[model samples]
Target: MTYVPDPARYDGRMPYRRSGRSGLLLPAISLGMWHNFGGNKPYENSKAMIHKAFDLGITHFDLANNYGPPPGSAEETFGRVLADGLRTHRDELIVSTKAGWQMWDGPYGDLGSRKYLIASLDQSLKRMGLDYVDVFYSHRPDPDTPLEETMGALDAIVRQGKALYVGISSYSAEQTREAARILKQLGTPCLIHQPSYSMFDRWIERPAQAGAPVLTEVLGEEGIGSIAFCPLAQGLLTSRYLDGIPADSRAAAIDNPFLTADKVEVRLAQVRALNGIAAARGQSLAQMALAWALQTVTSVIIGASRVEQIVENVGAVERLEFSADELAKIEAVLKG
Candidate 1:
């Protein structure tokens, strides 16, 4: 069967925002191929989610060199989807991938060194079956590698036509400034930043200054757009654990250390308190969290497990604005 996308995809169903001072206006919500698009996961489900996301006007699909359980499987999954239906609409999509974490075993396979960054991207392009990605990111700052060497690799990736633009992920405010300066000298200005942000995690919202050098402040001065990952705090901000954790929930998965059952119990009170506010706003806790996240980030990457989840999450765009009273109340709960 031929997959036909919704013609009304761009019909005001979604909103776009400028990424800092860049010309790119990304969907307020993008899709991240982090957990569910792995080789061990069902192929049909991953393909369905990607199609549904595109039909909802989400042009950006985020990936990384080491996204799958076995590593490199997510890119392969995405490449299969592209060939299945999205190949013709390539120009309408913004596919991005990253490196800088432990990808392969051995000395030259990880970190932000020139060898790792370049090799990782080249391997990523091959896995995704692409000549170039719309955006390429250094997954994290390399403390062991020279800042110039890492940023220079990014600059070279752009000049060599392997990436249309460059970005950084999980970099601190101070690190961002230094990298931006190096990239500027290399004639490739930083385009965006990918960070973890949610109501439970507000590190990026700190006051920006030379002494502190908060991320939000540095990005403003550097003219870089930001996309937040884990905006739902690994499902902590959602109603998933309101009544208690499900048997199959991420928190219950023993292999996933990012979230734990004990941690969920600790935050259950705060989650319920926040859920009440979402109810008053006539939205689900997940939707409200997505809207609130857009308050700081140019875009929030929605990590979904199924097509129904994508459908529900995209509705957050319909009620993105929150009144002053609402903001204050939400703050009170978060602080409490």
Candidate 2:
């Protein structure tokens, strides 16, 4: 079989927003390969989601070095998908991958050191069968590494033509300011920041102090765009838990590190309340959550285990706005 992309992919069904004063405009929702694209999964299953996402005008596919259960498998899966047919549309895509985590055994294989960042991306490009990635990220701030070295590695990657743009993830507001400043001096302005943000996880929206700027404020002041990760809070914001965690849910997976059944039980009240609000708005809880998060970030990275999930998640764009009372109610639920 062959891939014939939906000619109407750009027919205004999806909106593209400017990324923090950059020349790039990313789709409001980008697909993330943090799960379900692993080697252990059925190849056709993963490929279907990728194809479906692109048809829905999702031009960005986000990945990280340690994304798979076995690590490095997600990129391999994506690479295979591209080799199948998606590679022909490579120029129309924004393919990104990250480093700054424990990828290999040695000390030189992890963190923000110039050596690690460079080597990690090289391996990533190799795994994805690409000469370069559209965007490369630091993934996480290295507490033991100097900001200059990390940002410098990003700059050098751009200079090397291996990465068109560079970004950071999980850096604090002050840390973001310093990282952006260094990248600016190096002539490669930070393109974006990936942070953990959602209705349940709102640290990125808070000020460092009583009157200090939040991470988003720092990003706004620096003209850096952001794409929020974990915006669904590992399925807690979805209808999957509104009734109760299913046996197949992430929370029910005994080995799943992100969510646990016990935690889901504790938060069932809030989840059900949010679900009620979502129903009133004619949207699924996941859709409402994504819509709400989109109001603050440039885009929300969505993960999926099936193609149907991608379709439902992308439908969030259909109703991206909400009333002030809805926001107030949501705030009440969260606070309570």
Candidate 3:
């Protein structure tokens, strides 16, 4: 069947939020293709998810070059979907890709060096068959490279019109401030900061190695948007593993250190406690978790293994406005 844009796509139900001080507005629920959109998986499923996202008004689609079982496969698969399925809707999509972690077998394959960042974006563009990305990120902080060299490359990319805005992920507060300073001086001001934030992982609020809060108050102070990934804590917040690991779940399949069998039990208990509070407030545990993030950050970069998950997540937008009593109850349960 030929891809047809939704006839009522702009009927205006999905909510949009401003990203910090930037002029751009993003859909409250942005989709991230971190896992699952791989070559091994059926492309039609991923295609359907993207279409469903747009149908529901999810304009932003987040990606990384290395996001797949074999690495780079997600981008390649997404590229085909973009070409064959999303071609006509390109103008309606806010696509982004990042480079920082290892993608190939050499020194230049990683880090925030000028050569690596530029070359990686070029390769990512080729893989996705796009001339440019809406946003390009440094992925993570490079301990060795000078921040100037890194953000400088990002500034050049923006100047060259390869990326509309640039951001960083997993950066310490001091690093975030320094990078923002340089990027601002260079005329870009660090459009956004992507961190892994959820109910369980609160390190983003803690002090950095230099004794300064890693996120501090600078994100809000600088008016730089914060897009939190793993908002469901790698599915810990979801009820999928409340009983035990399902054979098809990420924890059951990848054996990623962050989500293990032991964590499943521990997180299940926490999820159950949180679920009680969510039930009191007339929301699902997943919905409450996502609402909490949206209440705190500029955007929640959520991932979904199924179309149902995305639908469930989008429903959370309606659940975003929680009362003070509801927030207090959630805090009490989390503390317990």
Candidate 4:
């Protein structure tokens, strides 16, 4: 049976923050339906995960038109859940979807072209059974397409009331600054930038003397929101890699080109050290990684394969803030 949220259901632990300079705000621990809500997954389990997230006060749900292994199946499945379970709370939800990579086989299936962006958004809306998305993002920068054209399409999407706000993902500091400028000029300032960040990954701390400030600083200065994905370094921050890689873990399940068995061994050392730090603070490694992200960025977008994982993730927000010494030690562990 499908489950609907209780009218009095609420969890006060998770926090919310404004999206950059925009009036829209998102939950501190937003959930991403990128991995587990796919075609081959169980419908009941996906529904339970979504319900559990809502119960934990995760009001934001991030999705994409091409998330499933077969592509577009995730949105379709989420549509089923929305239609059956969460439709009553639609107004209380912040739903977002993006389109950039590739989804189908055709000239109009990928990239940041105006045609592709608009078409993908339409398909995404249809699959989610929604009239408008809270946030529609250009999934990635289209180096081949002019930034103006791409941002123009995003602005148009907002103007048409198809998306309340626009965002960009996987963009560098330079690209994020340029996109923010174009969007601001168009009167629809880019709302947020989603990048991959974690304790094991510190790309955001690049030397500012070499170029402009890091993207996180740029977004904070430009008044654009910053939400990090893969905050657990694709589950490396969790205890799953502490002993060894389980067959069900993301690195073992998918053919990750970046995270090999050897890299897991290297990251295991980091995880062990970081785990010591988390234990010192009386938090799990997962909580420490998540709290580290929330302490660093405006929001941290997390993905979960089960309801229990979502429950554990929200606990990070209870003690989201950390101390100077903790941050210093985290930096040291990251450097090692």
Name the regions of candidate 3 deviating beyond 4 angstroms.
Answer: 209-211, 214-216
Of candidate 2, the 10-residue stretch with the lowest lDDT total is 205-214
Clash number for each model = 0, 0, 1, 0
Candidate 2 per-residue C-alpha lDDT over 156-258 given as tens digits, one digit per residue, 9 for 90 to 100: 9999999999999999998999999999999999999999999988999888688766898899999999999999999899988888989988899988878
TM-score of each: 0.98, 0.98, 0.95, 0.95
Measured on C-alpha atoms, candidate 3 has an lDDT of 0.86
Candidate 1 Cα deviation (angstroms), residue 252: 0.9
**Greater-TM-score candidate between 2 and 4:** 2
Candidate 4, superposed: residue stretches over 4 Å from native: 6-11, 207-209
Lowest-sum lDDT 10-residue window in model 4: 4-13
lDDT of 1 by residue, 252-286 (tens): 99988999998899899999999999999999999
- Write down the lDDT of every candidate, Cα atoms only: 0.93, 0.94, 0.86, 0.87
Q: Which lDDT tens digits does candidate 4 get at residues 1-336?
A: 656675544645667898888898788899998888999899889988998888888889999999986688889888898999688889999999999999888888899999999999999999989999999999999989999999999999999999999999988888989999999999999899888887766677574458666877788889998888889887888888898888876667567775667778777878999999999988889998999887777788888888999988888877877899988998887878
Q: Which residue pairs collide in model 1, if any?
A: none
User: Model 4 residue 60 lDDT?
Assistant: 90
lDDT tens digits, residue span 205-245, model 3: 77756656558488878888888999998888987766778
Cα RMSD to native, each candidate?
1.2, 1.0, 1.6, 1.6
